[model samples]
Target chain A: MLVIVMTSIDPLTLVLAIGTPLYLAAAVLYSIRAVRGPTIPDIILAVDCLSYDLAVFLSAIALYYKTPFMTAPPIMLALWVYLLDIYASKYLITREVGV
Target chain B: MIEQVLFWTGSALFIIGGVFDLLGSIGLLRFPSFYVRLHAATIGAIYGAVLPLIGISLIALGSPGIPGNYTIAGASFVTALILLVVAPMGSHVLAHAAHKSKSVSWKPFVDMLEEDEEK
Candidate 1:
């Protein structure tokens, strides 16, 4: 009885737990958009959104786990996304010629 | 005791919101045009990501057993607020960017961005 009670997730933890999978789903959706977007800006924007999302989702998971370590991956995720956006924007400006 | 109830309720909201978000994604995949796809993306972020974040906060806030310092609930709640404010702005930025870039043309309808572009 003690083991069952202690080991079972409290209702709140269960709630926090669901966020990881949902983040996974959203990440996939954003990726799909990034891949399939017809234009340069669309893809860049999708990538941007995905990166921001990974950051926030990572933070949330960190809170759930009560761990400071969960924070690191998202910071890196955001940096990578920002880098991609700058690259994509520069490419769009130079390559896409005209009205 | 109360935490258990609140957690379940928040989770239910999260699931419902997720479904709405999923619907929005499907709309994006299925929609015929860019403008329409914009609608799907915006709605998905709003309904799916933002709403679930709020639900998670509620669950955290309501959960018991944390000492009175309020860090657990407070931080989680703050996270929801940030998402709520930022999500819409992000949507607006993407939609505006997409509209202004003149990358995709809408079909069989009146278009304002085009008018602006023409000027």
Candidate 2:
């Protein structure tokens, strides 16, 4: 997908060219925090940051491809992260997520 | 003319958001403590995710090549909307959970929550 976006010489192409690498770099930094984090919550925070970034990256890809259907991924990604946060918080508070 | 303007606007937003994403990520790496890293992560979630979604939606809405359907634009809008609503709340929950679990210490310079927790 990125290759296709990069081959084109349009404004949207420019946006994707710049955005893709930046998002990847963010993910790298988040991963570092996740792996080296001193506490479980710190690792969870890194993952939360990483997922949000993935949603943004997906939106950029959708724009580059001009595919509306692609937008669905970001929505689902955000929703999933939110669910993760809820369960994580539940676990942190009570050590159980009720299932 | 309008399309060009919208495209450039979207481009600008994407650029700014990308810069923020990079900075936030660097902050995540450099911060001294878990709470500080959380601050950096929150910045990435809100600015990095939301702005680019809006920018992409604008580009999608204005471009002629990619179908430019209203549903597509609407989907991007919804994604951005959901991110805006969810990111902060998720961060807050994580912070609360971290505090409650004693997974990370509250070592801020002021330490207000520390006193409240004791009370």
Candidate 3:
């Protein structure tokens, strides 16, 4: 199966080859920012970006694999990050007041 | 012939989006402030995520080997749209909170928000 899949110069192959490395590089940068971030919001923002990136990567994989089910992960992740943003902000604001 | 067009277009988009994402991440690492970093992150989330998903969808739709490729493409489209909507909103929420809480000193030249709050 792998051999058959690799035999063709498919668009999916091209996308995966070009995109995966770039995403990995971005992830590394995000990790660096998360560790070195001076402020809470900065770290949270990095994490949020990372999650969204993950979703996008998943979407790309779904396309490459031609699996509709794979798309669901990206959708769930995108929505999840939004909620994280809200709650994180709420926590940041409230934590200051001793609440 | 149509598939060839789509395949080439998708490949181009994928490469372009990858470049943007890498640039955004570099900016995130190099930027001076939290707000600037937020800007970079927005670029990553928006251009980085959306464009590539679009490319992937196009590829899926064009590739004959994948079964139910249209369904996969539709899913990618929906995911990309959702990312487009949500990413900026998330950035806004984070930036607003950061500003309000004084988590990071922005020190913008205009200071409109500060003036408005004062008034």
Candidates 1 and 3, the one with greater lDDT:
3
Docking class of 2: medium
Worst 10 residues of 2 chain A by lDDT: A1-10
Question: How well is each residue in B5-101 modelled by candidate 2, as lDDT tens digits?
Answer: 8878877887888889889989988998877777888789778888877877777767766654466667877988888888888888988888778
Most accurate candidate by TM-score:
3
Cα error of candidate 1 at position B119, Å: 6.7
Error of 2 at B52 (Å): 0.9
By lDDT rank, best first, the candidates go 3, 2, 1
Better of 1 and 2 by TM-score: 2
Of the candidates numbered 1 and 3, which has the greater TM-score value? 3
Off by over 4 Å in 1: A1-9, A12-22, A48-56, A67-99, B66-69, B116-119
Clashes of 3: 0
Models ranked on TM-score: 3, 2, 1
> Taking the true A–B contacts (Cα pairs closer than 8 Å), what share appears in each candidate?
0.07, 0.82, 0.83
DockQ of each: 0.24, 0.57, 0.66
- Between 1 and 2, whose lDDT is larger? 2
